[model samples]
Target chain A: SQQGEEDPQALSIQEGENATMNCSYKTSINNLQWYRQNSGRGLVHLILIRSNEREKHSGRLRVTLDTSKKSSSLLITASRAADTASYFCATERGGGTSYGKLTFGQGTILTVHP
Target chain B: EPEVTQTPSHQVTQMGQEVILRCVPISNHLYFYWYRQILGQKVEFLVSFYNNEISEKSEIFDDQFSVERPDGSNFTLKIRSTKLEDSAMYFCASSGGFEKLFFGSGTQLSVL
Candidate 1:
């Protein structure tokens, strides 16, 4: 099983609506990063929140991290059709061997209807 | 904004043949990494390079795989003997100080 897992593998939302996706992980992490990917392309860094930090925001993207639950959520406010893509959460886990390397989640495919 | 760039957007090679994928990471960034994702699978980290050496690598990065920052801007990942399982989209990413990473468009390799 993957270290990070995202819920609602697929989501559909109307334009101007908000889309929220959740990610759960198994281990302790130093930080969690969110990335957006268009079809057939690479990921684009969206936002990152450290374990010590609870929430962060950039533009319409809002990210929240809960270390106690070992989970995070990305909220896209007033999503447009252009925001349609897959969103993945990657974690930098704690410990010796797996430090600094990111373990990605299965990802949630988001679709915005115009 | 600076973006990482990769060449040979798509390549097709035969089994057992050697293939080299190239990436030009964002200038002034010191950390470089290589990741791959097979179709319908999550992205997996292969290796991370810093200070002209490998800082960390996943189990997927085996003896057949190698990464080099042969020059200032270009970082390359080479596979000695390609197998069918090697068919996937390879992504290159770089970070400056913090963990805010930027990724290249990616190079899709198809092993026949």
Candidate 2:
């Protein structure tokens, strides 16, 4: 069973617009990470925010974490057609020695038009 | 600049046959993992390998499944008897630590 669930199953935006996607999980987590998958080929690691940290940024991506609510959001600013893809949020739980075994959400498909 | 690599981007195996999907993780990575995604489904964790032994696995990883690091570099997932249900894209991942993991291009397994 998957623990994480992403909101907005699909989104379409114009170029240069900002896109936001939300994710919610059911259990305590050590950290939350967001990933982007293009054409269902391979996933690219975007950003990771730990439980202690409230926010993180990398290039044009910004991620916010709320441990108390067990939710996180990813904001992509100045979106381009190249940003069209499926975005997923995966949670890392604590107390498990099998690290990096992520429970992923049913990703959000984002499409940016020119 | 290093990343995990998977061979035979696509594999078609017959039912009840044995199939071994191979992966080569990053050189310095200590932890390795396998994940599968059926079309239009969330990526599911199968198993994790570290220190040359199986560390942990999900319920999906059953007796029919096994993982082995045949060499210092290659990690392989073997299905003793292939089933149509096993058809999916299998991804190999590696990480230096528990926080971040880099994934491979993934091998699409098609069971006929």
Candidate 3:
């Protein structure tokens, strides 16, 4: 399977603490995206980092990609209870008719207690 | 902000029955896609449509599955015969290019 794997299948933290998750992929990719899915809800796009990018930030969320390691990490600063959800990393391959056809990772489930 | 929209949030169907899940992608987006997630499984891409044609599809998308842009605004996925394994949460996503995707609240399909 071309799917990626995320580390730390589950995490729990108190509100205001930072939460971090890691993802590793096997193939060359054009870009990697992070998405959040609340329980029984649709995925909400969080951020996207291209293969050439090393780090990116959106609000309190920070994403870092290391091509040499074929891995990426997502950090949510000052996490709140509302930040509790399953986070997934999806990689878009480079070749073929790769029009946003993403291979998703086994997500990391995060729980932030208030 | 524009967003993708899917109809029939939940559908319970019997085996061998045909089912069509509907989606209305963002108006300005040019690409549409279908993805599925079985309970606790990673999201898997099924097919992608662009310019009213299928641009990419996964092996999981077999002959029994079909996609259509019936009108200018809607995209639909049709499964000829439902199977127990077909039960999953189907998500419809649209993208302007490749930056980020807008996803709709998925349709939970339960096949019995």
Candidate number that wins on TM-score, 1 or 2: 2
In order, what lDDT does every prediction score? 0.92, 0.92, 0.94
At residue B71, candidate 2 shows an lDDT of 91
Clashing pairs in 1: none
Using DockQ as the measure, the top candidate is 3
True contacts kept of each: 0.72, 0.84, 0.81
User: Cα deviation in Å at residue B38, candidate 3?
Assistant: 0.5
Backbone collision tally, model 3: 0
When 1 and 2 are scored with DockQ, the better candidate is: 2
**How many backbone clashes does every candidate have?**
0, 0, 0
The residue-by-residue lDDT of candidate 2 on A1-114, one tens digit each, is: 447799899999999999999999998888899989999578889999998999998999999999888899999999999999999999988565847879999999999999
Model 1, stretches more than 4 Å misplaced? Answer: A94-100
**Which lDDT tens digits does candidate 2 get at residues B1-112?**
8989998799999999999999999999999999999998999999989899998999999999999998999999999999999999999999998478899999999999
- Per-candidate RMSD, Å: 1.3, 1.0, 0.9
Error of 1 at B106 (Å): 0.5
- DockQ of candidate 3 relative to the true structure: 0.87
**What is candidate 3's TM-score against the reference?**
0.98
Better of 1 and 3 by lDDT: 3
Per-residue lDDT value at A114 in model 2:
100
lDDT of 1 at B88: 97
